[model samples]
Target: MTSGLLKKNLVCRIILICTFLYLIPPQTIAAELHLALADSTCAPMKEAGLAFTRETGIDLQYSCKSSGLLARGIQAGIIQADFFLSANANWMNSVVDNGLIDRQQVRPLLSNDLIIVTRADSAIKIQKLADLTLPEVTSIIIGEPSRAPFGRYAKQALQKSGLWDELKPKIISKKKISLAVADLAKAEEGTAAILYRTGLADFMRLQFTIPASASEPIEYYAAPLKTMANHKEKAMFLAFIAGDHFNKIFSAVGFSVIHSINRAPEKSVKASH
Candidate 1:
């Protein structure tokens, strides 16, 4: 009789354990979601990701780099990301063309302005684009056009303004815009760079704004990969970013939230399986 009672108690404990496991949410057991984003979006997304983790109990991992590099990595299957946020439409279109992400699901997230900046204490005074050609200016740092959208925009603006040829001698191309900004910060007095107006370090001061007519519009697009397994959790994250709370976070960092007529509904974006 004692042996039978002991066996019965063991069976009941096993049943209770299975029931508990079944009741737990899938996200609680699944791996953390991974995101690939352009370096420029890191500032706001970092804060947003934390808030998402706190609310959903789903942690996030990030791989931030130049949009071109990130897109290439995705195409080559070298970077495994559940979602991607690109700095421009060109890179996003490339991923779409490769069938990595559904084009219909891509949505514009933010917009930024291009501007020229120099260290605050720099002796060189640049009031306009033409000022870059002055003898006092030694090197003008810019993102490498092939890898960074900001660099391509800077090149296009210079070409349109007819300053490309004249300024070519002093141009220093960095692989990423953030790197170019860093180079400017540490360089000698005459160094300057073309960068997104948002997130400039305190020591950096705007020299002049690049007019919209000078280059293609700067816009950011985001989409989840077609291969992602965590659809429900991914949808929750997407909706979180589209909400007013995330918008305020982005705005605080100087990003202009996009509200296009064709934008996906703010409540959710259904991922294509």
Candidate 2:
């Protein structure tokens, strides 16, 4: 009789364990939603992400890639991002072409400009964008124009100055602005580079800046992915992005806030995907 009671208690405990396991959801644990962003703006994203989590308690998982790579990832269905932050409208359009993002959810967020930079100790002095062609400047680094927005802007500025042909051979294409900056640091003597204003904050020895009027206005855009599993969480983050708090974050990172939360200005120069 004692043995029978022992077996019955064991069966009851097994049934209780199975019931507990069945009642709990596999995905109920804390998890971070995915965000795909431009590699150059990672610093500000991290700052904003921390603040966002503090207020919303939802962790953000960032995948910082070049705008081209991010777009391709979105297109190929390799990256299942909740939010996509691109440095240029062209790359964003590429993703949109793939129907990965909802059109109504897209909006321009901020703007930045290209600037000239040399190593801190370099003797090259550039007083203007045209000065990049000086004899002393042998190697010039710009991001790859095909994938990097900053690269395309730099190319446009150089083309406008009629120096694209003369400087094309000297331009070394780096995938990331930060990589280009690092290349500048380790470059042979007489090396220089063209980078975005956002990249200038972390580096020294700014030679000259391309006037905003001279270069095409570099506008960054953001959108929520249609495949997002957590729309409520993404909407919260998108609201934060359009709020004044994100404006400060962008300003701190040297970006000019567009202020319009729903659309980019009609006058802004549009880039082709």
Candidate 3:
């Protein structure tokens, strides 16, 4: 080929390469959401986090622990969290007292009921809170009130039902609500534990639901800490959590909707400022 023709071919090849490169999609930088959660692994928060990424292109950096531990972290100034979704407001309230988290930015987000659960094989039929007080019933599994909001709410509900005093001494307290539930039928670490639940989805093991009328409704809350420099993004994410996007995911995963009163009295919990 002539020199001029060869040059033209090289130019065409370069153009083709450049065009192909331009057609390739660029890498997207997903924003990081530092979230502190107290629920179980692969639980509601994780499910919602997945959906949040799909909808908003924000990647969640989630840290799941017990609500009590999360609360203690804020109290101890140990956690640097952008968002905090706790099982109860009491912990978030403590964070507010520290003046570290934006109080106006805090709001109730979701709620779960305190259910009474028992082993599926247990012969003792417990339909009411009063049944827990029976002398023959050796033990009852409950969450530790000091840390688990479920446990705290359980105690409060039992107290409201005039049953806490009788049931407190005959109980096995576990740090995590799931741990307590697991202990009801199984023994761990040589400790004779009998776990119980109120309304966990595990229907086969649950003795019977004690009903919301028997206890104060459990409250869940979320607060954006000062760690979020991008307030607009944080607000957007919070709205996604409160709106149908997050709620739908929560509902699909055995979580009763926050506004579902008939199923459970969950306030469509939100705090906007």
Candidate 4:
């Protein structure tokens, strides 16, 4: 009876061990890849990251910031993302110049447009970009040209329309396009703003979207970092973005997927004298 009872106890222990082994994962899952993208593409990118993980079991960790700041961070060695997507060419070039990214891997992926917007209850009226120059408009919010791609585009639009000098005094510069949009809602009466059209859906009083010809197209480029430890995973992520599936995600969020990135060599869009 004692030997039989001991045999039964050993069998129970073997069964428990088998169950625990079955519950354990077959292989350790990989850590998430870091992706740095422009703030404007945050929503769609997040969604895309989820879908990519579902499809490939490789997760993504996102860090969204203004393209300029991201470029500076890359230069300063403060940011270590496997991938970096910028809102404009200049910032991407800055990364390349700093020897942080390989130019061969860089490719344009999406484009966005600048738009003039105002509060729904704003008393100040605007028919065109020139309208901001009127004395009645107290303040105009814009991304600061030095560090914001949208602001640089907005400045170019104003300069293209011969409105920059006249409107510069009234311009209230914000560090990021998101901030400018948010502040526009709470701005005092008689104030207006310019920001990315992608983020203008919920906002009222969208005066007009600046034509691409008016301001240089806001091009988005993506590339993997040469220093990234997860080179294979980064390549997979870039490949995922290159496919039509990812383009659908971008289109849903107001970004136009562009097959061809041809444009005149980037020259500084100078403010009118």
True-structure RMSD, every candidate: 4.8, 3.1, 7.6, 6.2
Clashing pairs in 4: none
Candidate 2 displacement at residue 178 in angstroms: 1.7
- Greater-TM-score candidate between 3 and 4: 4
TM-score, candidate 2, is: 0.88
lDDT of 1 by residue, 1-273 (tens): 999999999999999999999999875695588999998998788899888888888889999899999999999999999999988888988898899998778888888988999999988888889999999999999888999988989999999989999999999998887788778878998898999887477998888998988987788889899999887887788888878888898898888998642575333232211
**Candidate 4 or 1, higher TM-score:** 1
Task: Kindly list the per-residue Cα lDDT of model 3 for residues 1-273, writing each as its tens digit.
Answer: 699999999999999999988887643545677888875433667777887788778788877777888878866868767888777777777787777776666665565555555555555666767777766567766678898777776777778888778876777777876676456547422222222232254433454555666554555667778767877678778677767867777766545546421132123332310
**Poorest 10 consecutive residues by lDDT, candidate 4:** 264-273
Tens-digit per-residue lDDT, 78-175, candidate 2? 87788888998788877877788766667888788788888788888999977887899998999899988889888888888899999888889988
Can you give the lDDT of residue 91 in candidate 2?
87
In terms of lDDT, model 1 sits at 0.86
For each candidate, how many residue pairs have backbone atoms clashing (under 3 Å)?
0, 0, 10, 0
Ranking by lDDT: 1, 2, 4, 3
- Model 1 deviation from native, Cα RMSD in Å: 4.8
Q: Can you give the TM-score per candidate against the true fold?
A: 0.87, 0.88, 0.74, 0.82
Q: Which stretches in model 4 have alpha-carbon errors above 4 Å?
A: 1-27, 260-273
The lDDT leader among the candidates is: 1
Q: Candidate 1, residue 224: CA error in Å?
A: 0.7
Q: Which 10 consecutive residues of model 1 have the lowest summed lDDT? A: 264-273
Q: Lowest-scoring 10 consecutive residues by lDDT in candidate 3?
A: 264-273
